[model samples]
Target: MSTPSPSSSEDVRRTRILSSKLYFDVPPSKVPLIYSSAYNIAFLGMEKLHPFDSSKWGRICQFLVSAGILDKRCIVEPEEASREDLLVVHSEKYLDSLKSSMTVAKIVEVPPVAMLPNCIIQRKVLDPFRKQVGGSVLASKLAKERGWAINVGGGFHHCSAEKGSGFCAFADISLSIHFAFVRLNISRVMIIDLDAHQGNGHELDFAKDRRVYILDMFNSEVYPLDFNARRHIHQKVELLSGTTTDVYLKKLDEALEVAGRMFNPELIVYNAGTDVLDGDPLGCLRISPDGIIKRDEKVFTFARSKGVPILMLTSGGYMKSSARVIADSIINLSTKCLIEMQGEQNTS
Candidate 1:
């Protein structure tokens, strides 16, 4: 079979996205947050090998419910991104590469996954990732309708069109922005990535795209040290290891101010990775839980003040305490009126 040209493939991808069911109508009764039980990954003790709390996605929702902040019925569930949906950003060759267990194992940083049957890996690992991708895409739609939205499980910032690593298996951030561009009629996007790790995946994907502005603040001493990706970042805040919360927040204040002066985005994609929390072995920063809460608040406040719609993705942070921290931050957002919960909207 003759290989299809890049333009033809691009046309095919645009068609697939136009016909996708990922952007379904959410009820007024539900909040603009997206998640699904399938977003979690666990199989035969395999998830334990990595520092990732594979179940963190589900646990965050659980805490939100138990804390009386969110009702279970008000949470939005997202469908899995079908193969056609993934092809929008990932090349067919890269999708074919994922059929290999070794490729998936390396991407997830879990060696045991390579020994398992590909079927098991697909069902237990990749399925959850696809669901998260769907949620990320849907979040853009929600953000355009509501003032802000959040995807409880996405931010695969280490995965590009042709590569996956650092526990990221798909380029969900890229997919989200593409969906926004094509579906939501959005032109400008600003990515505020505070994941404690450089978001090389989206940076490489949008390297030459002028419509997207990237503000990446990450630990300088960590993984996926891609200097090539750094060039793509519009505003780069490289924090060193053991950096404290006070310094981190001050840098963010300046970065946000500078970014505002640089680009006025119609949409803001916030990669709120809690790995910067102190004691996260991989993140290597010393940001405290309150600092994380404040960090999220600052970002949301900035977006709100600018009258820009924002969507948050819980990208990287897999510690046992990560769930509670995330839930608490969301609650803080609601508490501070940065975001409106279903109950709050109804009460108002």
Candidate 2:
């Protein structure tokens, strides 16, 4: 898109329309059962993709498809990621290493991780992130052009710039934010990662950036074993396990309020992880489904009220089939909220 010059008071009267397309792009084979051989990679191991199961996401999308919740909207069919897109955020060496199931026989003895062909790895890591990043881009684009839009697949917040961790191969929020910031020249992006895990990748990548504000709510002792966080320019909250939904929501409210006071966000990335649900073997915190909806509703409402466009990304949820349930909740809330935004604009 051609970057247009910012406007003054006269331009305020000519607000552009936002988009209303929610993207759902997951490859058929990519969404496999967590324990299947398809999920095994050389170094990534047999762990379920983060906390949310891909099978569940696949199932939920299918559910949405069957229910006709997703019909006649702008849809992005899954496509293999380009080397350029990967290069935008990952190193060439790492990208090459990811391509070859085995690393160059040199320095350290590489672990016996499942050796996924670069094509496979690219699909596993890049496919999900691309949908998320591209979805956000499209959503943000549509909102600017129409009024509002959404991407059904996103919230891959655990991903960093260089490597994959917590099942995240790449940083969805980072790439999307950078794409918008550089291409569209929109500054002040606010990312709210309400997953049960820390937005460590965001912290790792943009903790010091003056333009990005990352607010993460995660239990310190979850996966990756690196819970020690030094509050770099970003807001970090460590929620202890056994914390009730009320306490968690209250803290989230505080953080959202604080973020509002500090940054007038042009765009928001919301990582709605469902691992917080009870019985989620991976997540430490316990947030019921209803609680999650309530939390999501409040956050979406707050962002809309502030006139900040939001992009939803499904980050982590490892409760096997329950991944679908969690993802469905996020999609439902986002779809409803976006439709409401459309309504408000029409009324005005």
Candidate 3:
């Protein structure tokens, strides 16, 4: 078979995006907060081996609902991403590699997963990830229509189209941008990744693609340490391990200002990971709870000021308290009027 041209590849991706059920029209009564019970990964207590709180997605929603910040009925449930949707970004060989239990075990960094059958691993682990991927893709459409959206379970930033690592098994961020480019008629997209670790996956995927701009503020001392990926970042802010909240926020302010001047984007993808919290083992930064809230508020304020639609993904927070912190930050965003949780009353 002849190798497809770049134009032909683009056409295939566009066709896949158009035919995807992941971008179904959400009802007016539903909020742009996309999530589903399927987004949570828990089975046989295997999730406990990793430091990550596998049930954090569900906990975040529970906190919002109990606090009356969100109505369960108003939350938009996204479909699980089908194989065709995965093909939009992932190669056939890469997708095929996922069928190996050992391949998945390495990606998620849980050794015991290698012992499980591929079928069990697929249902227990990958299904939830694919659901979150779908949510991330749907969030773009909702954000474009509603001015902002949040997917409670996505932000798999360490996974690229051909590889998965750092507990990230899929490139939801890259997939979301591609879907928006084709389905929403968006030409320019900005990714604001403040996850305390380098967003190497999306950076590598969009390295030469001028349509996408990445502004990544991460702990330089942390994991992945992808020097080549760091070269692709349009705006990079590297911080140390013990950096306090004040210094972090100041750097963020300066970075956002520079990003604003450098690129004008039609859409913004905010990877708001709570892993930057003071005690997160993986993130290694010392941003306080209040600081996380302020950071989110600042990003939303920036997007609002620029009149750009924003979609947020809860990325890589590992602590047990991450869920509560994420919930509180979201509540703070609503209090600041950056995002209106009242779906039925929101006119803009």
Question: What TM-scores do the predictions have?
Answer: 0.97, 0.73, 0.98
Clashes of 3: 0
On residues 20-61, what C-alpha lDDT tens digit does candidate 3 reach at each position? Answer: 999888888888999899988997999999999999999999
- lDDT winner: 3
RMSD of 2: 9.1
Candidate 2 ranges beyond 4 A from true positions: 1-52, 72-74, 78-80, 102-133, 146-149, 225-229, 321-324, 327-348
What lDDT does model 1 reach? 0.94
Ranking by TM-score: 3, 1, 2
Ranking by lDDT: 3, 1, 2
Q: Give candidate 1 regions above 4 Å deviation.
A: 1-7, 343-348
Q: Which ten residues in a row have the lowest lDDT in candidate 2?
A: 31-40
Expressed as tens digits, the lDDT of each residue in 1-348 for candidate 1 is 998998887788789889999999888989987889999898999899999999999999999999998888888999899998998999889999999999999999999789999999999999999999999999999999998999999999999999999999999999999999999989999999999999999999999999999999999899989999999999999999999999999999999999999999999999999999999989999999999999999999999999999999999895899999999999999999999877334545
Model 1: per-residue Cα lDDT at residue 130: 96
Model 2, 60: alpha-carbon shift in Å?
A: 2.2
In lDDT terms, how accurate is model 3?
Answer: 0.95
Model 1: worst 10 consecutive residues (lDDT sum): 339-348
Number of clashes recorded per candidate: 0, 28, 0
- Judge candidate 2 against the unseen true structure and give its global Cα lDDT, from 0 to 1: 0.58
